[model samples]
Target: MTIAEQYEYWQDVRKGLSRRSVLRAGVFGAAAVAAGPMLLGRPAYADTPGSAVVPFGRHLAFGNDPATQMRVGWQVPSAVANPVLRVGTSPTDLSQTVQAEIRNLRSDYGTGAPLEQYYGHAALDKLSPDTTYYYAVGHEGLEAASGPVNSFTTGPAGSGSGLKPFTFTAMGDQGASAQAALENAQITAQNPVFHLLAGDICYADPNGQGKLTDSYNPAVWDGYLKQIEPVAQSVPWMVATGNHDMEAWYSPNGYGGHAKRLDLPTNGPANCPSVYAFTYGNVAVLSLDANDVSYEIPANKDYSGGAQTSWLERTLADLRAKPTIDFIIVFFHHCAYAVTTSHVSDGGVREKWAPLFDKYNVDLVINGHNHMYERTDPIRGGKPTRTAGVGDTVSPVTDGTTYIVAGGGGASLYSLPSNGPESYAGNVKDASGVAAGYFGAGGKVTEAVDWSRVRYRGHNLLAVDVKPAAPGGTATLTVRGISVEGAKAGTEIDRITITRTASTVDTPAFGSGALLTGAALAAGAGYAGYAAWRKHRSGLDVPAS
Candidate 1:
């Protein structure tokens, strides 16, 4: 469509969707004019009011703390006047109001197709812990439909507060597709407290590589957000960075678009804002940026200047030292130990970060990149500490970390090398089966390891039930893999139990030095330096999927 036609349609949208907000938007004329045309802002009569645009992609995230703070985010087709949020203890009386921050992101990929979108963000502060609150979005004369007044409950206040039980779901590679919508419905059915997107969130970049030759269509993000709103509108939808998320057309590192679309926590490392941590009840969750160290896709390798790894070590130490935090769940985009035929395990991940997980005795390490559901036995030092299977319970402090690859979040399915059904302890028809060789460390190793406990070629997501224990009780984490499509839709493909002492400190089987010894630390440091030097010399520019 021509520019004039586009403007006319947007104006028609305003007239048909919200007449009151448009009539009241004359006051914003001077402000829009002051913002200049590059931001796509204009005088009252020329621009469509944000309130009239009908906000879509409503989602939530934590504001540093999950108990008393929340960050509400949404998208608008155009700018509006003082976008605000009204929230309160009950939906009927949303008397408390807070002004929302507007991020005006304009996309022009040198293809003569320019698109502008306004993202609204609001951080709710000083909320009561363990309390449920209802909220609505819009500004001045406009308001979201009152029928669906969304509500969310805060987590427990502090550590060891006898927190109530909660459930959270996770998945990855959720591009806009019908299969993804089914998984989303299944996720909403679970009514989880929060959710995690491992990575490759929306394939707007298409290439899935951080390269300059990739084609980008920022409008695709609009559809992606609307698709996930069924569940994300209420649950805190936390996300990580994947290789497909990079947009080189925006900046040198190609994350300029990511920074605008999602308002993540700024409390992570100085170089990597996407990598952050937050605690809910007895669990401490950490989100990482695997693109910086992913070997399979080195398009944007070592982008974080080694600061991410250093910060991770310190964060793990701090969480493990706290007695209130029982479980440490680290999630990223790349697989540390996956046995899938497509995009096998990433060796750089294991070489750099797996040892840190072992040192802190992390309970669970979740990943997404393989596009399937797979689990590994409790592993330590490149080997399985115990053979875990269905109906089996394992202790992280005694055995090792459990790695789970739940990449089937709305994307196409990938099969194992064997092209067989899932392999469980009870259903292991052959012990000599080799699913696939791991990639990383400069070569592929064809070692037939038995750590592959369960592998299912289906679209699935992980639902983790965290049952907090009392002062002297046993706390347990129950994980269930739910299939979202095919004949096994809604069936549990895999389940496992992780038990920990309620109020005791965890004693890592491997001492601190045993994992990241002086020699290993030196090697890691040397590798980081070498990566930075190579990046500077190569001057490579690539886009993320």
Candidate 2:
């Protein structure tokens, strides 16, 4: 069938139409199913009845509030009875039991039996701030506490001087490869509080065009999850949707699969599952759904009807207005400024959200799509504000937004310009080695200027160390690109420091006039008091792990 015909058939399937009705409409026939398994959902591995229902793909994600809430998600081979999660301060004493919410997904592309997968999510709310919690997942036949236990540390108090330093890792286009597995181990060694998967997760849909003709294997998610479970089970594996994530058969918007498989924050505009915001320490991170605004792959473009962008601008403004949030980092799939030969940049992202990023002085923008590690010089108003070389310090408040394409997350590397001198940590290239590439609508327009700074074509992930400072001090985020391949595996190939004032609010005077000092001290004391009150209201303290 043609792409349009296949799309129509998938649409019918998405609408819950009966197979007879679909046949009556001549959407497909037995010949189509007989053509190949690619057109039909492949058979899932059989799990004998009475066998163990081991949970795999166990991952964690923060709720709207990272300080006191967490969502644990996992997958089982087949449907299980009474699936639940148990949490406690110690691995041996998981006393708090919560029933898991099961989301079952079925994919039937052709005439074969539909592929069925079961996912479970348990929300752990009102957790104590900065405390470690150990948890396990199980069903009726399995013992939750007896199973493998994973622990995660909650974020520090969201407000007041209690803010603590933290580390996080990010990368995209991570498929289930040996390189990806190696990267996961590298990420675990960083001891990040969370990990941002910029998108193209698992590449279940190889075509990634959101067309029915795209080859998809729902089981890829199974292996992919198990691959990252070592790290994801502890660190929040925050994810953004990429073009490959759009599975048309699942839902009208092609996110039903994701909705069922992953439990993400729902604080963004309604129906946009992947767009949300969370804060840890002094930095606020926004995860955007780039598929909604991707011009290169217009399959799911404008799916949110501008609501996503509107919410994004509002969220950015709100985050920027908060004195506690010193840095705002936005991450999505398609790149706004990349100079790769493949899928260089998305005009839609630049057109829709780049200005808002600049308007809010977004400290850093991380993207994935082109399968390589590329960073741009600090940019503002569609031009490079300054050339930010590797190991250089950049203040987004003054320099501009620094964009990094950390797509080398376990996926095969894409080609960098062979003729040009690519710059990276330990190697800085001058403008004399300018390379030409095309980027824009459909990534077809050719324009070759120089904003691409560091380019490394290897399996790598970003390790970011965030330091919180007092009201009048400077907070810093040190980003390092750690390669996962070759002799320099686990070595830093790129590094940049982003710094900003700790807060917009002024520090209280210590010993001024009696009246002025009294007022200032009272105000400072009131803020701290409020923070303590809020913490008390959230939950009682749990012993640190």
Candidate 3:
């Protein structure tokens, strides 16, 4: 069928009407009559060879325990009988079979017909740490081992001598475009243990305001998943939530579709699926839902009733107390400290979570929504502590937290404020006075600042190499911002090293009025309390999935 005819047919389906009804009403002329048989039940594309259900958009995610558990998720064109996953250490020797869970989603938000999608997830548990496993998805008619196979390496063991070096990539605002495809290829070349997508996964909802009036096309997700499947099938594509991800048709919170598509850790709050925590080796990663704390887009702000924030604080405290955890990284959608022209900064995120991050001494915070790559100097108490030029090293324990705006994953680039010469690594353009804004009530509040260190208006992604250290030693995280621009493609736009003591006892820089009881301190204190507590407590090294 023609594109116009297919669109009309889907519209009729979405409206609970069939093409036959539209034909009887004489809506179409000769073209509708020519495509009537194909539009009656299924589209022409649905007829595959042997009528076998083909799966696409295959992706992988880590469960609560990255060391021993992994979740594989994929989408099928149609519902198939007994979807299953086959796994083994060798592709030739497929030995394990796991049942898959189906999550079918239906949406009828636009004028077109309602759309229904089928997704399958299989949770593999009790796997060995640091092992490479091959897996494939299939159903009854199609043998699982007969399909194209992919492999993923489980994370290193959490404690003891098992701590090892690893690499991970992060980016956000990645839509299905050539730039996005380039960044994905770059990430695959890095061979990261996992990829942290800071939200804005796909531009399914172009108008990111969480409104019913926004153009919503669920098909965009299909192309996006297919585009990223080459990399995501091997590397766990860990994701957070962005404003564009808030589709009003999904659910009350607009994350029901996310829950159906991505199989993230459920250790967060009861209702908030986007907010979760996971740990790999010495690094603890927390994914937050920025829409709940965004002032600029208040459509879904404060929807979690403070539960997400409370969980974040508790999770931070817990991770900080573990001697095995050397770094704590938080990633979300809105920027807490960025100087881009599009969406400068989110005051709600700063007001709500900055203090908590300060108290816990978060190592690094990654954000998107600005559509550019901007980094800040080490910040504490809402101000830059020191100048962190590219290639410079900063100690998070003393200097403060570093914020990176890596919104250059895909989509159209947003221009940086034309205050000074274009600044980046190696070539520095120091801006004496840079005008910026913080989004809040009554729109943005313009201001001036000097913390906008490195700004690159192009497509980029963050490749971080983490080197673990023995107890009482020092660990380092080497962060590199790789540019995907035309001529400067694969060049480094920014680089920094975050060094911290591996397993030392350090006191948190608690803000004023932050009181902690003895029990609370014992439960949520630094490594000192955990070291003392470890003498009496012993259990599984990794959390259960």
Best by lDDT: 3
Q: What tens digits encode model 3's per-residue C-alpha lDDT throughout 182-247? A: 887689778899999999989988888775446667878889999999999999999998989886
Judging by lDDT, tell me the better candidate of 1 and 2: 2
Regions of model 2 farther than 4 Å from truth: 1-51, 109-112, 158-161, 436-443, 504-545
Model 3 residue runs over 4 Å out of place are 1-51, 109-113, 504-519, 522-545
TM-scores, in order shown? Answer: 0.82, 0.86, 0.85
Q: In order, what is each prediction's RMSD in angstroms?
A: 12.3, 8.4, 8.4
Full-model lDDT for every candidate: 0.75, 0.79, 0.80
Q: 1-545 in candidate 2: lDDT tens per residue?
A: 32334556655654567888677546456554332222233435445442477889999999998999999999988887788999999888999999997777776645667667888899989999899999999987788888888899988885535677778999999999787888877897898999999999999988888866567888899999999898899999999999888876655677778888998887999988999999887889999998888778888878888999988877775564455677889999999988777787788988999998876678899999989888888999988888778789997866789999999887777887655455677776655335554345645776666788888878788999998887557688999988887787888898999987565343211233122222222234334432332223223231221
Model 1: residues with Cα > 4 Å off, grouped in runs = 1-46, 49-51, 111-113, 143-148, 419-421, 424-430, 433-435, 441-445, 504-545
Clashes of each: 9, 0, 4
- How does residue 57 of candidate 1 score in lDDT? 90
- Candidate number with greatest TM-score: 2
Better of 1 and 2 by TM-score: 2
TM-score-wise, the better of 1 and 3 is 3
